[model samples]
Target: MSAAPEVKSADANDRANAISTIVLGFAADPMARWAWSDPSEYLRIMPRFVNAFGGRAFEYGTAYVTEGARAAALWLPPGVEPDEAEMDAIMEESLRPEIAGDIGAIMKGMAEHHPLEPHWYLPLIAADPTWIGQGLGTLLMKHALRRCDEEGIAAYLESSNPRNISLYERHGFKIVGRIQSGSSPVVTPMLRPAS
Candidate 1:
């Protein structure tokens, strides 16, 4: 077997490539497509959405990428969070009226399922379509979860694609609840207790 890909903390120089990988990885994601059904819209808005939702991981040195930037995971450490205001603005300006109306319920559902205590939140994790069969996802997960385990802090994430649920479960995440807003795909909120 070949050597496993290395997972490293992504720096500012890696920001564009890392975000582009995630954008490509999530191109067909149900939740993402539901919000931006138009191909043109998805292309235009996804990068901004990624930035608004998980860009802080880069600043905090928690964003991870595998070799060739084929996979990425953005983990927001305790006390850190997505830029809610920017996210709100992005959705407001981009989503269709029908989709925009559901944003409130979707946000409420996410908040309700989110852990109240301090924990690491994985807002996004994905592998480029070209590299889906490789072990990059598992590699990235282990790299970040090691830090969470060492810190004795819990980790959480919402599975936007059902195909990825098994991968998260294999990494010790358990589905706590489901979040589904009007005309939106099911989002599974999962948590991995502190080890």
Candidate 2:
């Protein structure tokens, strides 16, 4: 694989690029596809959905992107998880009310596996679909994992794509639990303890 791209802390100038990168990179993701079913529909609502959940990561936590904004990773510091009311509002507004129950049940089931102890969280990470397997994701993950190690903090995430599980596992994350409610795509929650 080519060397990982240079990693930089995202600035205000990078927010829009970062968000666009997420929507585009995740366009074919299993969970995303499951939620929207139709490609056009998924493209339409993905931004609002990403903004609702991943916006806080940029505002209150940390966001990292490669040169040219080709890839990105959004990390949340301990205690910075989204507010329940805000998330609920976003879902109600951005998603069809029909899928609300399924969404709710999926989230609730996923939450059951979260570690109670303080930890950093990775809600989303993506390379432009064109850049996958070039090691950008690994570089971005190491940048954040280094900080987690410095603070002796654990890290957590729910992997929506089975294909990425091994990549995360290579970084020391272990699958702790799985949630599969109704016809929703499986979400595997993973945790990596402080090294």
Candidate 3:
């Protein structure tokens, strides 16, 4: 039997490609839709947000980018989730002042639901818009989950876009909880036990 094609683990050298993939991939995501109501503002602020988000993943945990930047995934390894200060920094750097308070509450709500047990956290994962339905997402998910299995750690993620829940379900994730704060987008938290 042959192994799956490898998705490259991103490093400092892959920063630009990985950031671009994340921004393009998540531009229309539910959270983005709720936060950046203006298309022009979304275009301007999303890249900064993704850069900060993916940059943390790249620096502290595992970041993967498929060939041609079609897909990307950010996984924070067990015990590597960012601290309060880091989260505050991320919000400050990525979000606009007008939307900051609301997004911060959403972030806090999401964080409160995170599993206390050690696990791998997937904060961002996406396939480029042009590459959707082409299996790039599956490739990245499988690759990262395999690593989690090897390390004997559970996997966790919050699906901001309901459309992608089935995709995560297919990869062994089950909804553990749901988060909805006022006007914020509904977030479904999923967990996949270590195999």
Candidate 4:
């Protein structure tokens, strides 16, 4: 059998590949589709959204990739956060006006459910569609959770796709609450307590 894929910190050189993996992984995701229903819009805006939402992982050396960027996880260390300003700007410019209120409510709910205490946040994790079912997701999760365990700090993530809840649970995460708004898909906020 081939050796298991090794997880490594993603550098700037890996940004495009890593982000593309996430984009393709989320193509069928309910929350993502609800936000950008048009295939063209999704293709155009998702890259910016990924960068705004989890790009810090790249700068902080917390972005992990494996199998030649076939899978990626963007984890924000304690006190680090998404670029809210850029995210807001992107949404304001790209989202359909009719769904603006729903989007706002969803964002508000996400913030309300977010843990106030410092924690590692996984804003995004995905494997290229063609690479699914190969343990890449579990590999990435274990690689990051190892650090969380070592530091005795909690880890948090919101599941944008219901299909992924079980995968996160398998890694020690528990659903703490849910976030939803008019015409929007449910977003499950999960937390893994410190070891």
Candidate 5:
């Protein structure tokens, strides 16, 4: 396949944009968004996630920075290849009460019960609000999907709201579960096979 546009890899320069994209994505729902609403907190927690997840966390992201103007983004970590049991345990452990109040407790509980293997959660993805409907989200998603597909892997993520769920469905993700965050357990969780 012809290569996609020359997108930039997530780096220090892109951290602010990346963090902003993440916040906006989560901001769709007030409760779940609070976890990382603060930019400084987002930075602190991201590295901790990377350390725990063996880089499955988005210490770096893929972005079509030029055309989309920071529209396309996905915070996915690398290393330790995706594994199911380990991921739930990791996600559950990370969600412990020590992590955050009600949010952590709920996620930790869900992780213990979560059934899936090697699920690669997007955690966050958002095109510039003004840039939606122009395929920027797909552009970024395809980049990661293609990479994961090459490894014959499947992935997963939970959208902050139903509207975004459609965007994910249109992009080939399937609704695997419905997540009602403890503070506000209304968001839907979805999954997709890498393509």
Candidate 6:
């Protein structure tokens, strides 16, 4: 009923919240086929890679209360930084081990190309399934994109649910590629300009 909630800067501990929320958000999508539980899987692995991008990882939430908030969030790692081997280690040691994503090809491609360079990931932008149509995704995305503009960098993400394609388009992302992992479409790569 109210205008959702105010979006604000997230603290250090919010990174885990953001990652876990993303997994939960796509859990039901027939295309996602994601495999992970709430809290434990994401929280345990986030710290290992939170600082991977150096002094640029950020988390923002949309809630009156910080704690216990299913806040929509974004994770924008540093731009122009490269740590190829380090990123490989993060994926092998933490991300894949903790979150059971079926998209081996997606992970493999990420392993090939470094992710630390100028990009934003909407890793956790869910606001309770019941509240989905309330525009929380767009609100969170806008907040993330504004920061990306302030820093003059690009944003990237892969939408598992085809239904969300238009939603992403409205936010300046154009589908760059698509892939099928297993029986369902694994990921749809989208990029938003820094300009």
Output the worst ten-in-a-row residue range by lDDT, candidate 4: 109-118
lDDT of 2 at 26: 90
Better of 4 and 6 by lDDT: 4
Clashing pairs in 6: 79-118
| Over 4 Å off, model 2 | 1-4, 94-98
lDDT tens string, model 6, 1-195?
A: 745566666656665565455445555655433422345655554444433522134522321112334544545454433244564566576444534354466666543433345676653345556557767677777877887799888887766577888989999999877665554445677778777
lDDT, candidate 1, at 126: 89
* Model 1 C-alpha lDDT per residue in residues 49-132, reported as the tens digit of each score: 999999999999999999889999999999898999999999989988987767778888898988998899999998899999
Identify the leading candidate in terms of lDDT: 4
lDDT of 2 at 23: 92
lDDT of 6: 0.56
The residue-by-residue lDDT of candidate 4 on 79-181, one tens digit each, is 9989999999999999999899999999998888778988999999999999999999999999999999999999999999999999999999999998988
lDDT of 1: 0.93
lDDT tens digits by residue: candidate 2, 1-195: 866469988888899899899998898899887877777888788777777676777786489999888899889899887556766776676666677788899889877887899999888899889888778889999999999999999999999999999999999999998888777889999999977
User: Of models 2 and 5, which has the larger TM-score?
Assistant: 2
Which is the winner by lDDT between candidate 2 and candidate 3?
2
Stretches of model 1 off by over 4 angstroms after superposition: none
Measured over all alpha carbons after superposition, the RMSD of each candidate to the real structure, in angstroms, is 0.9, 2.0, 2.9, 0.6, 6.2, 5.7
lDDT of 2 at 95: 63
Query: Which of the two candidates, 2 or 3, achieves a greater TM-score against the reference?
Result: 2
In terms of TM-score, the best-performing candidate is: 4
lDDT of each: 0.93, 0.85, 0.80, 0.95, 0.55, 0.56
lDDT of 3: 0.80
* Residue range 120-159, candidate 5, lDDT tens digits: 5565566656656766677777777776678776766666
Q: lDDT value for candidate 5?
A: 0.55
